[model samples]
Target: MPYARLLPPILLVFSNVFMTFAWYGHLKYRDTALPKVILASWGIAFFEYLLMVPANRLGSTVYSAPQLKGMQEVITLLVFAGFSAWYLGQPLKWNHWAGFALIVAAAWLIFLE
Candidate 1:
């Protein structure tokens, strides 16, 4: 795809990445007494929705709702993969890739002829 063609998907991908972190990263702070991470995550989530809503609206023009949502779920996994690897420094195991492959296969099925 051309650079311009990639812009919306890229934005959606980034938005989902931020969203995944905002939604799940707070789990790490569960042991803390204050547990302020939930509040912080909510703040971050606001921005995630800000980008995500527009991404869906714009992407809808080019992709049907099912396709857009499918893409969003895949993008969410992709973003979560990176977030898990980077922030948590977790290893990207082969089994994880295998699971993602299954998901990609599902996407193919969803968009199939």
Candidate 2:
């Protein structure tokens, strides 16, 4: 298989890692000033967009828009699940697994011809 097809998902994984931090990492620092937290999140989000934009562009070469989006969502959840557990100390519940399973099923449908 061509390695170019792997670039998008790899980049998306990195992008989602940054995004999960940008979006929820602040929860651990809720005592910090809101403006400072917002600024910090924005800074983190900048890196996320840098990877995310290219991931989508490259992914478009091998996948449709919906497929790319579905892939990204799945990557996002996977990244967030780890971040939530390790960084935020929030473990996944049974419901979270069930919800994620549904999303995975949706991704399967998106990838199906």
Best-fitting candidate, scored by lDDT: 2
Candidate 1 lDDT over 1-113, as tens digits, reads: 24434566887887887788788787667775555877788888998888888777777666777777778778888888888888887858999999998998887677765
Instruction: Flag regions of model 2 displaced more than 4 Å.
Output: none
- Residues 5-110, candidate 2, lDDT per residue (tens digit)? 8999999999999999999999999799999999999999999999999989888888999999999989999999999999999999999999999999999899
> What's the lDDT of the predicted structure labeled candidate 1?
0.78
RMSD of 2: 1.1
Task: Give each model's whole-structure lDDT.
Answer: 0.78, 0.94
**TM-score of every model versus the real structure:** 0.82, 0.97
After superposition, candidate 1 runs with Cα above 4 Å error? 1-5, 28-30
- How far residue 71's Cα lies from its native spot in candidate 2, in Å, is 0.2
